[model samples]
Target: MNELLLTGDERDRAGARLLALLDSYERGLPKAEILPEPDRDVLASLLAAPMPERGVGVDALFDRWEDTILPNSTAVAHPRFLAYVLGPPNGIAPYAEAVAAALNQNCNFWQLSPAASVVERSVLEWLASVVGFPAQAKGILTGGGSLATLQALATALNDRVPDFHANGLQRASAPLVVYTSVEAHRSVDKAAAILGIGLDNVRHIATDSVHRMDVGALRAAIEEDRADGLRPWCVVATCGTVSTGSVDPLDDIADLCAAEDLWLHVDGAYGALFLLSEEMRGLMGGCARADSITLDPHKLLYASLEAGCLLVRDGAKLRDAHAFDSSYLTVAEDPLMTDYMDYGPQLSRNFKAFKVWSALQAFGVSAFREANVRTLGLARRLGEGIEATPGLTLLAPVTLTAVCFAVDGASDDDHTALLERLAAENVALLGPVVVAGRRGIRACVTNHRTSEADIDLVLEWLQSRLTGRR
Candidate 1:
């Protein structure tokens, strides 16, 4: 037998060693540096090295991981790192991720992964219920919001065009047009361009003063497209814009799509999960009106990377866009078992749903809701703190968890320096946002790990920096 196949004694020793390393990680978790600068030369050498021709034993591999991989990666889990729309993984996430990997469930079809199939369907059904989608709603878990939006547009194309799959973009008789606000995520334009909808046809409709999509501009754009002999096919609305966290007027946009006989897709990837909190239901009530929606559980639900979802009101349409007969992988769709391959593009898929579902099951929905509510409240508090400070000016309305602000009398350079200084000092890791033509430091308090104390600390750091500049 090959030495690679470990005997009973070897297996036991390896297991014990692994346990010790994991225990150290668990014990040192709290004291670990929030952000550690990496030795890039060492990292580069490891990355550039040829895949070793010979096997490195587990003991050696773990040592390399502790010294290299763990330190080089960004520590998004640090409560003080308030940048971007990312969330720290829930406590159960790592364990669930390991379990899913061990099981190695191919979540494509029911027979291949019976429990995974049921788990995925169950998760989708629950998400649909939260969005108030009816019994006919269906969805597939995706890598992230961008992929979900892209897939949604693909489904819309299949539904609207008579021969999209058969003769894609070959005929130019009536070109399709897509409409979205200027503040919408770039994913909308990307999808249109990929679908051969033509960049010129994508109308970046004007936004209102607060950055909500202008309903009137949308109407005029559709009319202008019709007059110009262009096909107005769909509308992509944002629940929370990437820059200022503005929610495009979803109800009005949905009405326009209906009037124009076009598909309505809501990019709710960042904001939709906020629906879990009772405080956010009214603000995001319009999501239910969308024919299709994209949501990111990884961002808000605190699942590890790569857990996003796309829900369609008419779930059958998702299958319509993607389903194709494959003789080798045939399995009749059983009511009890969902053949997820029919729902989206992939036939071989990892069991992503289990990680998300496991988190929800372990924490319960109410805990997530409370944590989201707290994050929202903290953002508002930080915004208020910025407004109260004499030198700091609010850059945008704190509509959600993103707080954008600029230090008074500070040039763009000053603002950038301040941000970098805070990050380097381990005070906080915030990002930048651009509104109209002006740029400012932005903090997205989306992590459940963050608290009011962390926000106050960041605020104090900003105050001291502002004082020093004077």
Candidate 2:
């Protein structure tokens, strides 16, 4: 008998157990604690456990998962899990993930994973169409937004820097500078530093009142860098900033990039997929004009974790940046398939696109659109409630699904205490933010399970707790 393979009867039993587990979890999620209090003894026992010479039967394994693991894990899928941009996986995610694991497609090459290659390409095409990219556009699924941004910057360097593939930064006469807004994610700076661009070469431009990148400041900074004999290479714009969900001025920035001949990479990992909503198209349409953009499928698409994408307007440039020849790996190109090894850095990539495509196929696009629209409405509801309350202040506009607000005259310590109390009482799991130097709480309604009632319940609890404290 194969040591690793399960017997037919055992497989059947495991499948039934998995289905029961999923059903029970979904049914009990609402009543469960958003964050569970871990038992120290149980954790200690788990850590002290050693590898057994004999295998524990599948039945016993399932028992351990249900009795110990399930109770200790955070209920991230809970409707009131409003902490970050994270959203729970859709109903079909777990099934799709299991199928993908069983198939084990190595999506790096066309020969090894023909169907996976087609699936990924089709998914990318659909995404590009949503972003209004032309037919020539090409992209690859990534680990997440951070890696996507890093890959985009690397592509920019390969295209802009003289002899980049041959000599890299060593041949440059002066330092090359990258510009982004002060509100941009830390991934931008991290990408630059990793690419040998150095933190000193990155310019954090000022922002406007609504927390968008100040275009004037960005333009002036670019010119100033040129005047100082520094090479201005790329501009990283944000579609939705982390704190306030503010979108940078994409049209104006695209125009500036055109005039300046600089690469424009929009970090839309948090908000680009909002384009599914007809209402968001006008605000996020500028994504099409970018040379490259990053998107996180796990965020808006509600796929399982670690699903991201990087799209490049000029598909040839992306390949030019990373493609290398190897005798053992070389194969005749097929017209219908993409050799993903030429697209990005990975050569042993998994089938990350299957989960995304499966969900879209299972639920259709309209379902996601409706869910996004609902989240937007719920955010507006929460914002209005906060504004109407006597002791609360809306720190920033409800741009997307993130509602940032502060308690009137509340100290940072007080805000921290309030957040802890809310989590401990299981009212909601909100995140903390500092908007324009004021410490505040942020409730991001990204979960599809979130409802009008959930929003109202959180508001009522907050109002009661802060009734006279204001």
Candidate 3:
């Protein structure tokens, strides 16, 4: 086991190799492919290889990564990679991640991870302030937005369901119903199902022309369910819907949830961070009224993968949902630090906040705000361009950083072919989306590396393709 630890020379060599790899990757990102079709033969070889009793040494492993791994990976940091609401990691993320890995802190209990606990708390505090949540707001870092939503639902269960910990939904008298818009992410339904709330009990409420959840329809559904003797447990509203970037009427939904005594959770995984921009506050400030909100720092904060958060208005409720005591893990509480095991589902949690904190500390919040504002501008530009183009149709309002549009008189296959062609030619990697049964292409300006020129190039390509000139 001791041999697993590298000597000082080995550590130095590995660190130097990693730094070189990072430098080369940053320099080559401009010309890199946004999407790379992997070689199945190479992947098959990796799968078939047997584990050796002895390690192959660090040098050989680094060589393998350069040769077999780098080529097959998607260049998510590419400037023109505008498929999903995914952002490239900030400049300092790699260094922070490396440091966190070396520290190997389990951010579960305060005594075991005092400094990590404070760091995570600091990050959560800033996030809460960003969303305009009250000082009492507290949250836990999660795997991603999906997991955050799941945890939010779990917290709601503990808060609303009588004796949830004791009965665990097995002794429920009436079927519990969850309400969300049809435009909401599938994660809502998945969470409901996983939490023993049957899919049949979920009401996919109708949306308006802009794809926002119709509050009237939601209210009517809740009333109908109540009349039918079913319990309306929770409402999951989308701050930025995945399909069209439509924000559900948060204030109206919050009012309804309050009156009905139902939990209100805003899935702001894609759009919540937009609150960083002063211009976005009006559209998203209503998120503060939600009992809980899900945010993905990895999406808009430019943090590396696997950084999502769930913030609850009443912090104690979140702790009640997941805290468990064990004699073997007994530890004294500290006034300045938090035992994060009381917050969410994980017992052994990684120090995920370091990368986010490091990026913010290195670049400052103003830098991120500027980048986000720019992405919003680029999205609006794309929408305007699509509307101005002779052969294209704007499918949805350019809200947040997602611009969804379709080619006039084109079928789903036509849009698919265009996507494939553009990706093959390295013009861009746009995603496919369907709004109100209309299939179209969606370009989300979530990449900090994306520029106005890149958007222009994509539009130019589409125009050329439409005119049969390419």
Candidate 4:
């Protein structure tokens, strides 16, 4: 037996300590600082220290965590943490994560993790159902939305370019071009650059007045690219742009993709899961028509960090793009389970599906749907507050949970200072955004913990600040 293995007593003590720590953290979340101040000296000491030759024991390690680590960590679960598209983890996330770690199941192959593979399949099936994809749709859990989009592009490349696996992009005669709105996430550009689809080939088409990708502009751009001897390979539509939470016209985009023989990849990372609400389905159901779609459970489903999904309309295309056979890792296929290694880049994958599955099983789907509905209501409330305020101006339509507004006569510097002041004062954490060359502040009410009181509190503070400034 390994000497590092803890005895029963030691394990008990460690478990007790960890449970206590978690309990304290949970109890304090409502009152904790949204962003903690770092102790520079302690941080520097940690950076300068070398790894200890021997273990410090569980008790000492737990003490170190409470003293040095916990104080410096951001309280992302705080009710007032409204910055970015991130949300607080669901109530059962920690337990699920701990159980997953304890199992330490390698999800690459069914032989190595049979139960995990089934669980992952179940999760994917539910996600596919949520998007209204056909029974033949298939997917894999990814690191995040960015990786999902990357994998989707890779799959599209394989489908569009003949012999892509054997000759990777080097033999293509015409440059492949991708079309997306200027409001699309940067991940698309990053993926294109990484996949050797030169940046110049990406057309950042203009958006309409409401910030959605203009289908007319997209069609014209594709035609222009074809005239310029570029192969219009794919169209990436945003299902909730990061800046303004504007969802592109997916149905129109899908129609164009079909007409042009282009792959349609929807970057639905920030807003896809809103389909949980029957009301949102009308706006986002068109995602099901895309050749592929990216969804971030971490953002919408409130799963712990590092859980994203990629769904392909045609399962075979995804397998064709990524599947590879190796003699050493030969494992017979089982009808009951999926070998996730044949799906994406990683061969030693963690069991990310467990947390997502556990959260759904624990809270039920209706709970999430209600929570999302509440967030949408809160965003609308915030938008109304902004409009009612004297100096605040709504930068874009409050189409989803993200509310972007500009302070009249405030420059970029003023917004920066306002954000800093708000953070320093523990009012709320809002992110900076740029919309159509105008700088502003963005509040994304994706956190389920956020209440109407919290929204009113922040709005009242802003209104008071503006009043004092005048």
Candidate 5:
């Protein structure tokens, strides 16, 4: 018998325990602390423990997970987990992940994972349709938004820089410059740095009072770069910025990129999937005009973490940038399938698509749309509540689902203390933000489980604290 293989009875017991654990966790999510204080001694013991010479068996393994692991884990699925852009997994996510692991599809080539490649393509095609991309558009799932942006910039370089494959950034007559709003994700700067575009060449254009990218400022920056003999190659727009959920002027930015002959990449990791709501289309519809866009299913679709996407309007360009000739992996092109290895940087990829696809299939699109709409409403409610509160001030407009506010006359230290207090007392887990240099609290409604009652409870607590302090 294989040493790693579990006996039939052991496998049955393990399955039962797994199901019980999942059910209990889901049921207990509402009561669980959003951020529990971890026991350092227990963690240290885990680190210090040695591997056993003999097998621990299924029951012992489950005991370890229940007694140590579960107690220490963060309750990201809790309704009050409104700190960052992270979202809880959909109900189907765990089961989908388990099945995906068992299948163990390589997902690189058609022969190795025919069904998985098709499933991934179906998911991508559906996403492209939601963004209103043309049939020629193509994309690949990434580890997250950062990697997707990096891949997009790399594709832009290959497409714009002549003979880039043969001579990458070496012996160039002038440095290539990229443009993005100051509110854009740091991933843009990171991508530029990694691609040898250099951070110095990336211009963070100013934003307007509402935090949207200042188009005039961006245009002037491009003109200045061109006059300086630098190559202005691309513009990274933000559909939903990190701090304020502010969407840059995508239509204006797209027009500028077209006139200047620059590639347009929209980083919609935080907000693109908001398009699932038809009501959000007017605000975010300009995403289709981009040459490429980055999206995070893990953020909005509430899939398990580490699933991002980069969709390019011109499928040929993405292929031109990433595909390479390989002798051992050659296969005739089939219209029904795609060799994912030709799409992006990975030669060995897991079936990340399965979890996403499974969730969509199980819950249907309408469920996700309703969930998004609900989050938007809850955010609006919180923003209005903050505005009406005596000691609070709205730091930014409620654009999507992020509400930025501050306790009036509070210092940065005060805000930090308030955040710690909220988390410690289980009032709500909130993040601290500095909007335009004034430190504040940021409550982002990314969790589907978050409700109007949850928002009200947090607001009531904040109001009382501010009143007492005053």
Candidate 6:
């Protein structure tokens, strides 16, 4: 073969086929019933089989994806999909992802991906600006919210402990403790565990009646830990508790951190991006005060899977935590740009910023703001509907998109059955939520595709189910 991997004609043909496949999926969204109970046999056939002796061509792969793979995936783009806190990707993601793959920009360093580095910086700056942080704030896009939180915790660990990377957690004189509400995401605990911070070191602080973290109790816990000679270093606050969409008292948490000289890390993965709307700015103003914050672009920016960012107010601290020089990988960096390899654990990163920036540009910031506001409105409507229903008891405050409600005389098994029934009938897919040790059906309106009509249909489904049971 000559010095070529693929001929120009072959490349063009592949591109054309990809474009066609994408077009077909986009067109299928409209009258597609929003969901279809997946044929488990067909799905198992696709995944259960091992690799073939001969590779499947692009055409066969595309055919397999269309025929078998897609139906099993949750149709988050469907207007009726109001289950988990998942956002459908914006229209530009498919084309942008294709371009990113073709270009194969190594975003770990400026020398390897200059334009990509700048574009990522631009996207991060825009995100920081929305949170009312200054230009000095710095961040990097990671795989998703969990990775971002993991990176943030690692950075905090580095900042508080001297020579952490060298000695590791084993040599530390005192074990550091992290405070978080019981309502916090499991990602916090997962990150702590991954970083060698024992589970016992994590303090599951109690929350108030409304589910926000109890700041006074947190202070007491920290004081107790300190008195016991254990180091209390960081407090992880959550913006959206997964079960109830309850936002922690950020202002109070920030004040407590300031008084205690502790790192304040806000896990804003499910809720921070709402700051795009002016209406949410007042409630989330204290986000600017956080030492570091984690956000999920896949959830809020509507970017395709695996776009999360960890933003830090002090850029130098992030660098201090992650940057290290090695003979094999050393390279010069420009003052204006970031060598992102110095910012996170991964060195070979994809050009994730292109898809995020492309989506934002194609849809505009106003569209996202309106979409967020619409979701908030839909959640409030859902809460009111649940309250008005004869047998339904609104379990928690509808602070955000998550609506949890208990049906009279329904056991946890009843809720599980009801959820399956809803999904099987294509009424609407809702999961279960546990509130005060009792299980209830949870419908979260996180998708921008979800409309008021969809909400009413789900309510109708509930009514029909209740009548059938009676």
Query: What lDDT tens digits, residue by residue, belong to model 3 across residues 374-405?
Result: 99999998889899999899988988888989
**Alpha-carbon error at 71 in model 3, in Å?**
0.4
Candidate number with the higher TM-score (5 or 6): 5
List per-prediction Cα lDDT, in the order shown. 0.88, 0.95, 0.92, 0.94, 0.94, 0.88
Clashing pairs in 2: none
Distance from true position, residue 16, model 3, in Å? 1.6
Q: Model 1: per-residue lDDT, tens digit, 24-45?
A: 7656644456667878898889
> Relative to the unseen true structure, what is the C-alpha lDDT of residue 34 in candidate 5, on a scale of 0 to 100?
88
Candidate 4 has which clashing residue pairs, if any? none
Q: Model 6, which residues run further than 4 Å from truth?
A: 1-13, 30-44, 47-56
Per-residue CA lDDT of candidate 5, range 354-460, in tens?
Answer: 99999999999999999999999999999999999998999999999999999888888999999999999998999998889888999999999998899999999
What's the lDDT for residue 279 in model 6? 81
Error of 6 at 50 (Å): 5.4
- 1-470: candidate 6 lDDT, tens digit per residue: 65435467666777787788778777876456556767899977867999988767656777787788777766778777777998788888888998899899998878889899999999999999987777788999999889999999999999999888888787839889999999999999999999999799999999999999999999999999999999999999998889999889999999999999999999999999889878887778889999999998898888998899999999888888999887677677587778998889989999999999998888888988898999999999999999998889999999888999999999888888888877777778788899878789898888888888889988887877778752
* Cα error, candidate 4, residue 237 (Å): 0.2
Query: lDDT: which is higher, 1 or 4?
Result: 4
Candidate closer to the true structure by lDDT (higher is better), 2 or 6: 2
**Each model's TM-score, in the order given?**
0.96, 0.98, 0.98, 0.99, 0.99, 0.95
Cα lDDT tens digits for candidate 4, 299-408: 88999999999999999899999989888887888899899999999999999999999999999999999999999999999999999998899999999999999999
Alpha carbon lDDT of residue 6, candidate 1? 73
Off by over 4 Å in 4: none
The pairs that clash in candidate 6 are none
